[model samples]
Target: MNLNQLKYFLAIVKTGSFSNAADDMYISQSSMSKQIKALETELGVDLFKREHSKVYLTEIGAEFAKYAEMTIKQHNDMLLYLDEFATKKSNTIRFGSIPVVSSYGISAQIAQFTTNYKPDVNVVIDMHETNQQEVMKELFDGAIDIALIRTDYLDEVDVFDCIPYKKDIFVLVCNQNHPLSTKEAVSLNDLIKYPLSLLDTSSVIYTIVMKAFERHGIEKKTKCLTTRHKILMEILQTAPNISLLPLSLVDLTLFPHLCTVPLVEELTSDVALIKLKKRRLNKITKDFWIYWQKYFQMQ
Candidate 1:
């Protein structure tokens, strides 16, 4: 019925579980179910069949899926074509960033570049804030000219040239009332006894945290899994559950009730400014990239 419903349908098909699809789409499971139900009602057909723990497509759902995928692809291609057309007509630099851009002072750097370095240049910085997956997707689709993303896709090193700006380390986050808050540092073994609220399984941080626990032979009792940091933090405060999050995302000033503790094992991800290596940049985008390169060297 709607684009979002179509996206949710595909997410359910890809993940094979309602909860997993909700995590992938960064929405509540109930909302996902309701939307899918609405979509089914509109079409007058069931799209999924559930057997115990897994979800499978119905016969008609398989046929609809092919059309749904084609529709989404066409929608994306249309946006990309529009972006390319707009780029030719205007002095705009389509800059994409993940949610935690402020944590790395990326916005401040951009401000300095525009205001201090090239105040006379009539360039518009069109900023897009999204998750890591979409950031990479838009960058590849040529919808966005440059992006600040995590170094999760190591295989794409040769495809894009990037400058590392921040080394984001993992830390334990909990409310002041938590038992672990008093500790300077905690180990993976220490976390086993407590209820844990972690990032979604689809997230890069979640994979790293799980691997750390596995490597240390620790079994984590994950009580909740979500992509929203605010929800994750609120859950920590409402219950005794704790979370492992990036050091930059743990803001003590914003959440005075919360405290962060270092992990005994080191887990880190680099936040970088990246652009396609072979793509020809417009004057504005080219200048912005060159300015950032010089800015990093000066640092």
Candidate 2:
């Protein structure tokens, strides 16, 4: 019913006991019990079922937990705003960028944000390893105010506004010693001739590269190597392996020995900035977006 009640319920569910929840929340067990009781009374249903001295959320309890989580997140964000920027002149915004986008000028944009809009706005950039779908989860859950992600990977959240960040490219990379490495570009013939070391095709890079390969009529041929991320530099560092990777994966610092050239064919990927529909983007997110645009222009 209230933020306190939701907090109590979540704590109980997490700690699995009233006494433990009270300890975690630093409240008296009786007070914790009263809050739970009041919540259960208001809902007119049992939220937790105790069995063998263990407590678990009942069917409705499980469902209400979701609502409680959303409510608590909203309340907490409000509290943060009140304490940090009571007058609302300057506000802090939190946002996220997948590692790939961060390399593509997202961080630089955020850094330069205050150069133009001085005072009252703080931007916090959180690095997350989420793909497009998980990016939606982070945004919708209010964990991040906005996000920079790959466009092709956007989840089914139709309400969010997506701004084009840049025209990024995905390329196939391998050791220079690789047989196909000497070729100016890859072809189905070139790919078929070699065993492929690849990242999980379900990953963002794979999806982007594979879709292009499919359109070009290249059959998917993979060899033994597989990884979640870092497939590019990993394969390159090792010998006789091939991987699909974003062009930026060849950063001099990250992959000191890596050399990048365009693949035989054109494979394009886009970076995008997205936010929840009709949501008020706090100063932080907006500043990041504005600077991101400028960064892209300079590039």
Candidate 3:
């Protein structure tokens, strides 16, 4: 009927006498007898036959004893499995970031944080190209433990604890053979003269570049609008058009013929680490958060 009752039944069968089994289990014979009786009543079968001073198991009792042993083993194994799962969950930290921050340095910082701070903990990093609002949503929904995101698109600051990690300058990138590449610096007016390749209007980079153009009262001459950097790079390779991008995302080594020049009008955005204000962080996440705070402070 229950685990303890089944255990008493098994003991009676193993020891071959109820009194001896009760003594081995440290319970009174009367109590042990009552439990075995209750188990038999629940199963509608007699488990033992009693002689003058000894007991012998009935045919059904021997069969049920094996199942009782198996059940207890399975129960203990499940408890052990759950214990291990809880330990692993506490030691793992899930980190998320935008592509720019992941490409710049956060990936390496995560490796260093694990090696220097909590070497025993596990760190999982996820990178996506979604905007700041979606990153905030992931933090709110407990999808990620921490996120590195841009501050430019953040409309509400009260929901999260934000720490500025790096500042990225928005620059104009062009192929080395392009006419703008010959100049040391180029103005927004100069950029309008050539056909432009721009990020999608939904992107923060597009908003910043357009605002700079609006201030100078110049219409943007866009030849192509794309969200993919590979396509933008391909466009710049064949066409004499330039596109705006964050300095962090521009790897001059990868695109050997590409050159980045500072915009005449200063445009920049802060990349920050953010987490929910009230959410409790696990030990690994908290340790990495402190490491990053101290790391940026030294810089």
TM agreement with the true structure for every prediction: 0.69, 0.63, 0.66
Question: What is residue 224's positional error in candidate 3, in angstroms?
Answer: 2.5
Model 1: per-residue Cα lDDT over 220-297, one tens digit each: 767899876766877777688889999888777777788899999898877899987766666777889989898889
Please, what are the lDDT tens digits per residue for candidate 3 over residues 1-299? 78778767776876788887786566899999999988889899988888888988889988888898777656544543453458666566667766564467766877786677655655554445565545655664455768887778676589788889878888889998988898888888888778888877756777777777888899886789987566687778767889888888787776777898888888887889888775667666677788888888999
Give model 1's TM-score versus the native structure: 0.69
Candidate with best lDDT = 1
**Which residue pairs of candidate 1 clash?**
none
Candidates' C-alpha lDDT? 0.82, 0.67, 0.75
Least well predicted 10-residue stretch by lDDT in candidate 2 = 83-92
TM-score winner among the candidates? 1
- Candidate 3, backbone clash total: 0
Could you give the C-alpha RMSD of every candidate to the true structure, in order shown?
A: 7.2, 8.3, 21.8
